[model samples]
Target: MEHEEEEDRLSNLPKIILHNILSRLPKKDGARTSVLSKAWEETWYTFPILYFSDGLFVGTFPQPWEGFLRKRKNFIDYVKRTLLRFYDNGLAIKQFKLSVNNFELHYMSKDVDHWLKLASECGVELLELCLPDGPDQDEEGRGECYVLPNGVIEVKSLTELVLMGGIRVDTAFMNHSIKFFSLKVLSLWAVLSRDEHAIEHLISCCPLIEHITLKCCSVLIPNVATNFLLESDTSGVMKSLNMHGLLKLKTVDVQGIQEVYIDAPCLEKFCYCPGDFDAPFKIDFDRCQNLKYLDLLSLKSSIITDKWFLELFSKFPFLESLKLNNCRMFERINISSVQLKVLELSNCSNLKEVNIDAPNLLSCVFYGGGGSEPIISFLRSSSQLEVDLQIPIDYLDLCNLRESLQNIKPQNVLSSLSLFIFQPTEDALNPLVFQVSSPPPSIKHLHLRSVPKNEILFSSVVNIILSSCCPATISLSFNPFFCTKAFIEFLYETLMERKEDGCFCGSGDTRCWWHGLKDVKVTSSMKIDENVDFKTMLELLGFGEEISFTLEV
Candidate 1:
């Protein structure tokens, strides 16, 4: 009776469902499930997905070279055995992923080639291979690399391909145009090829490819200044993506490219992250009428002036989202997009001011360093606007921050408001707390983030702001390095005093006041002690049902 019940309850799932359940598990775990029953053994053997990571099988390799060699052999043997078992069973694999870190590619190259060829012959649909990435790689290309075999590229059933870290294609395959008959998405990260034109040729050959991401694939010059452009070596191909003749490409992300010349007409979205070199980039967007998003990041020491930035906005009348991050060389950014809805800026160290007149804008985020506070203005009123700002604690001038807040002119039903005070210095505190010039009214949710050392200033600022705006929910990011013992006690005392007496006022000053705040939230990184019972303290204070406490590890 016990055996019958076990079979009915645990082993009754259908074969297809069992196979799917095993497919999602790790390769080792899936193989171990064969000990469950005969039905599970058959299901494990037929599972269609295999993912292997050296980190999962072995911990960080220590100093001894022999230890590394032993672990590397074990990793290789595990993959070989898994693939061999599937091949012997005549089972088709839908996807194969292999990620190795801190492994000598020179010794494992042959094994990798064999595994890829086996996966290709099994009609795999998706293949991903990732290796370690390092900027200190040998310039003369003496480091270990995988020269991908032709079988993997010529696989007729592969629909997605992702290659990362020290990957290259055989020079023999570059002689003729190569195409992936079924590939729709291709991503390359730190991939090296013999010819820069090979990437362009490959994109041209992929008739169905739509999305491409090339991340950190540029080769660096060791002691070169970033202000001047580096000359390209046409004799040898560099690791950069050249977007030409890609008619169907909808999205393109070129990250850390030394030199790029792009002409993708049908692109709907584009992102460019220029590397340290100040090389020239030519992007022809004349035919990208459908383009709606453009992102630029880490363009340090850029030669593009404010005039070019304005021209870019003018060129794409339909652009809806624009994000700029750490793109130096501009002091003032003025954007007037009729259709723009979202704008974000972060870590633009040289930026001093921004004037945006987007009538349709709905949200904006601004974050930067402490050199000088940038003046942000929204010329047109956005009825449904929300803004998130992260500013340096000392860089904030009370008058300027008030002016900037008034510039937005948020509606009565504000979408949201988030303020984070970062990099608190000794100069941040003043004798008297400054009042918010134009306190946001009717904030839906308010978040305040600060370190424990600046708790006094953070609390004083929160008090002044809450005196103006009445937000429905308040969130706090509390670090407990200093205030672990007395943080909750401080909140409890403040809230109880405010609750007992409706508001506070000076003897002869009518302007001094406070609010009857009912809701309180406390999130800390550690719990202090059981003696300080939070629930009992709140109960004694006569507050109920509106308090929340979270302890984060």
Candidate 2:
């Protein structure tokens, strides 16, 4: 019997549906669909959004300098032709993104200006340009950069503008009469401006901006004392960002800024990372009562004290997530937030005690460094709370590790524990010893990562970890420089070969945790290999960066 022919329902779908499908696909894949049929070719032309990158046009293999230049030229021509097609057809471009790397700004400045003019004429709503500095960029970053044209700023239809890398906002920007009146989002990364007023003018023009990100953006101030200075003293970097009445702003992320004054009442998230740690840092959120997420990094102990945290929680009552990194806190601080769900603390060395009373918290992650361990106490937390602790283990200091682990309250559920083992100094020939006073807490998974110099050190480290923690599953990740084959063999021999006789506690104690082990399985990329010898498996699977061993006790 003959089967009925399948209908081409995909191609026959509505244009809007086809456009949606194409939007979900990568730019190259979406453009390739035009070759499928004439109907698709028409749909591709009217797609309304164009994204082009010089990197996408380059081949995977390294090409000669001449070939590279030819490919770059072709990419530029292709972008121009694509934009021209939309302009000629009078179709509104919803979004236009162009990313150029390794291209000299002077060589392509005119072409970039032309492209912007075309996009403006096409009524582009969202415009993104990522033009990284050329190889000739000086250390001071006052080198040649693509000066944003006045035409782009005058585009009243623009709703979102993202300019990254070696772009400059000159003094002309401040004098421009037209502004981005309809813009809702503005992101400037590594963007250079003539002065602080230029940046302030650019932002103040965007009255409807809801989100703003300024990362590593600088202010270039030409040195007047040319005889005394060798080069332009580009030291006038952006020190402060003050947003007075951005009522629509919801998110603000400013890095490399010493001070930030935000008065956005509707702001929901704010992240700030100071440019200089030694410089005096100041931040004031006047009326941001609707904030939900706050992230601060590299703050001094004096800036973030117990009183500061009290004022923070009192000001932003709706904060849900708080992340503090490399910040020095007071000796003891209380984080009493009822709405907090996620809390992350990293390298807060000065914190001796932390009391959290967030009953709605769902997860808390702590990353430790060489500083003294902070005793974290949770007065009230959700029953479903999961705590993740990443602690570094100095081979010479086993007692410190034990003390750090013991500092964690027994009531807190440690879902995952990651131990970063630091190699001992070469002169330290003494064998390290670890004593387990009581049974280790039940951890769902234990991740051990280290770059041991030899197999003997790796074996000793593994034994010490197993003795300290009774984890259901243990994951091992090694550096590629080490011989993974030897490590795997040692692990297999220790966990499987000597399972019945060996005790990880070093002392001959039969009551060890692994004595009741029923089965041991190896998992690679989530696939379990049962009853397999490590030597043979290593030969079959070759060397991988990570390997997991599951213990059935």
User: Which candidate tops lDDT?
Assistant: 2
Residue-wise C-alpha lDDT for candidate 1, range 326-406, written one tens digit per residue: 867577777887898988887787776677788888888777564455767677847776776665443244324334344
lDDT of 2 by residue, 1-553 (tens): 1221122566778988999999999878998999887778889998988888877777765669898788879988999999999999898899999988755566788899999999999999999999974223455554457788877888988999999976888787665577678999999998887677678778888879999999888877665766332223454558888887787999999988878888988999999888664678788884899999999888874677888888888988899999999987788998898889999999987778888888999999999876667888888888989988898767766546656766777534677888776667777645565664555566788876653555557655666677767778877664554435566667766788555444654444446677767777786652436566555556555444567888888
Residue 178 Cα positional deviation in candidate 2, in Å, after optimal superposition: 2.8
Local accuracy by lDDT, each model: 0.65, 0.78
Name model 1 segments beyond 4 Å from true: 1-37, 60-68, 134-142, 219-241, 301-310, 329-334, 349-353, 395-404, 410-432, 435-442, 452-470, 478-489, 499-513, 521-553
RMSD of 2: 3.8
Q: Largest TM-score belongs to which candidate?
A: 2
lDDT of candidate 2 at residue 398, scale 0 to 100:
55
* lDDT against true structure, model 2: 0.78
Q: Estimate the overall C-alpha local distance difference test score of candidate 1.
A: 0.65
